[model samples]
Target: MAETELVCANRECRIAQGGRCIEGHDDLAKCLYYGNEPEEGDQNEADDDQEVIAPFNGVYLPDAHPLDSRRADRVLASLPSRMIGVIGVHDSGKTSVIAGLFDLFQMGPVANIIFAGSSTLHGLEIICHDARAASERDEPHSERTKRGEVRFYHFDVLRDGLLQSLLIADRSGEEYEEVADLAANATTMFELRRADVITVLVDGRRLASSRDRADVMGAIPLIIQGMAENGAFSRKPNLAIVLTKDDAVQASTRKDQVQRDFLAIIDGIRDAFASHFGEIGSFVTSASPKDANVVRGAGLAEMLEFWMKPGAEAQGIRQHSYSGRVFDSLMIEEAKRG
Candidate 1:
């Protein structure tokens, strides 16, 4: 103090005079900088940035639905029969949903279908084979890698007393785009084209995703439009727009935001067809395996239930759709006619 020492400007410098460092740290020469705060305008710009929307509010029903006497009697009397094709974009859980339905059907929880393998009655034993993708290169037929692998299995049933088994033909996700022509033919000219019902399982997350929505919607229009225009889905076949992965849709408090997002997507798809088809039933479901998370599994089932027969009702068999029942009845009529 007596010598009037000048402290170095560097915060860590111990030098008593000017800008020189007394600590002998060679890096002091590069420390001539001050931290500056962001300008106020930049903060304002950040406020306008887009925000990610939250998921939708999904419904979950309890197990073991109570039966409706009148409805059950009526449905059984008519006994819905038809080749119901379930389809959707890749990773849409079409196979999972079918598996779950099979589980339910075997348990006799859903409708009582005439199961094959028993020597009691006569009905079709449906085969569910996942067609693999055909290889591009010169690979042996055995070596030809399955482009798309089927996900579900085939079941046999005799439709003597109830609606027999369903032959679940699983086409791999890889084939979704490539098989549009096949799907179209399936809906239009194939034997199942005359199906009494058609269940299209759509992936909720994919449909909700802003990225994939457009392309997916684009791929489906031709098939659906062709189906409707060619009198395939026009039988007023009780159409079930089964939504897979409902848990993802409802795992948040941001349903308003998510619904708007999905609504836009669905509307876009609807617009693509341009009033070509009527409003089909909508359902959300989660068909992940036992180990799969509950949210995903339950969510998918919920979505599917919303638009389908039993799930569409008030959370039970009592609340099934008469339209769905009617659809089943029509299919049975078609089968009987055949």
Candidate 2:
């Protein structure tokens, strides 16, 4: 089949083609005058070139279901479902965690897990540090910078015959007050709404600090609770409270007390979450584990597997909850069902 192309030329009307606008006409007076009208033959040549050179307009590629396609049915049939959502918090190490997971999933034997690495979820990113910009107007505009809003990155892990992906959304660091304002007033709501799950990253070491504790703890829960009350959380998405910068927490401890400190910090976070939001699992994540710490280095993969497991919500609460093969777990469940 021969492909047809279209173009438009009216400046006011974005859709234009062949020196004429999609409206089928344009005012020559408003257009830049070339002093004289071109010959009909020349105009025709230009139109032909535009038709040849311009990309096809008003046509979007159609969506096709892989499972429904005859050629891909078998592979698609074996593919498992996906669970995805954005992880939140300014210091939450959201990007670092996602990046680490991408590396692990790509290199590991797990084929069922997939990572869709992208930053354009509905075309939004935390572009500016909103609070800083608002607070320091006296600072030179050049000195002020904005962190882009979070984008969605996809991670899929397929192993033991199950295929699922986690779509991670991230945002820039800003004060909770600003996030609340934006959440309440912004026209773009999907960024805050599109999540099958939401992992609120908490700064573990700072949880007890008086300087910024309230901003870190209170802001996040308030926003989440408000969302729940407003029906946004009706899906009752599984919430994962991640304690970011585990390395920092570990580094601050005495050599002999490292394990105790780690456990205590995690316990504090878990307790606080239970007190405030009623029991969410807390995972300690170290993006940059110290050399010689192989056990800690593997934390990312371990956490990913735990969080993405099929029945994690039910099973996560009761167990020591580490070192499970998600793909193997899924296979066992499916085999039993059959």
Candidate 3:
């Protein structure tokens, strides 16, 4: 038969130029569509034979899961836990501090606290990924943590051969601000209430600057007042007022000047919340230290020792804890010296 005169047996085939199928099969016998046309009974059979693929059943993985309160509760149910909650305003260095604490225990033993393991290794990797990358590139900026999410970084530490579970809450500065502003009613507030130790991070670089000191100092009282209003201080959680970015402050000014600045901020916190709580411990910390290429958690170990174990070197004058009356009197004495 001539090419044009020839017709495909399959009704689904569109005859192109010649006797070829649209799929480029020229021979009628070789064409996939040739005898594949569905008839009345064939349609039902084909439909019945078709296998349906199920949705993925193995597992779903994320870069990191935000340790919300529910996940924290579940995690705590599995272990004997001590909760350390970090509080700060936006860019006040709460995440960096938590990452530093992780690095400290992960790298090696500190003050006889051996690095055992962690349940949320992926979560730690996500939080520290940028800072690790930045260190390699010699970049000035570290990663900013996710805002408004309260994440828990888990750690198993062996202190003097005794294993203990440590849960540190990494919350954004905005979350703290919300509570400070009396706006937060979410799970974060409850997390704060449950915290065994609450550390308030004050940006050292900002507090060191004359122009920023007033605003920074002014915000401290409001946050303390807000926490007090929300009953965070009702149980009198162990308070640590951590001055972060100490490296930046030291690089820009004299050591004595930085000490004065540190004292002022601590005094401000003391004045604001002293009567509400029994004792407060203040420390200067640098997550990214000057001599280290990576985060060494330089000042974190001391802070941890002070809160976790009572009689480490943190019991000295630098990490001293005092009652409300004693702290107020010290503040008065320091004010007279200035």
Residue 157's lDDT in candidate 1: 46
The predicted structure with the larger lDDT, 1 or 2, is 2
Expressed as tens digits, the lDDT of each residue in 101-202 for candidate 3 is 777776677766787777788877666766665546564344666675567887877777677777888766776776555634433466677777778888
The TM-score ranking, best first, is: 3, 2, 1
Q: Give one digit per residue, the lDDT tens place, for model 2 in 1-338.
A: 98544322322334323444434445644444222334567667767877755666787853321111232223223445333444455545555565455545446543244544322221212222111235354421111113543334433455555555445544454532354555552223344444445566666445534465556655665555444444444334555666666665655544234344435545654554443332255566764343334333246655665556543222223333446767545432224434
Highest-scoring model, TM-score: 3
Q: What is the C-alpha RMSD of each candidate to the true structure, in Å?
A: 25.5, 15.0, 13.3
Q: Which segments of model 3 are wrong by more than 4 Å? A: 1-66, 133-135, 183-188, 290-295, 310-338
Worst 10 residues of 3 by lDDT: 309-318
For candidate 2, give the lDDT.
0.45
Highest lDDT model number: 3
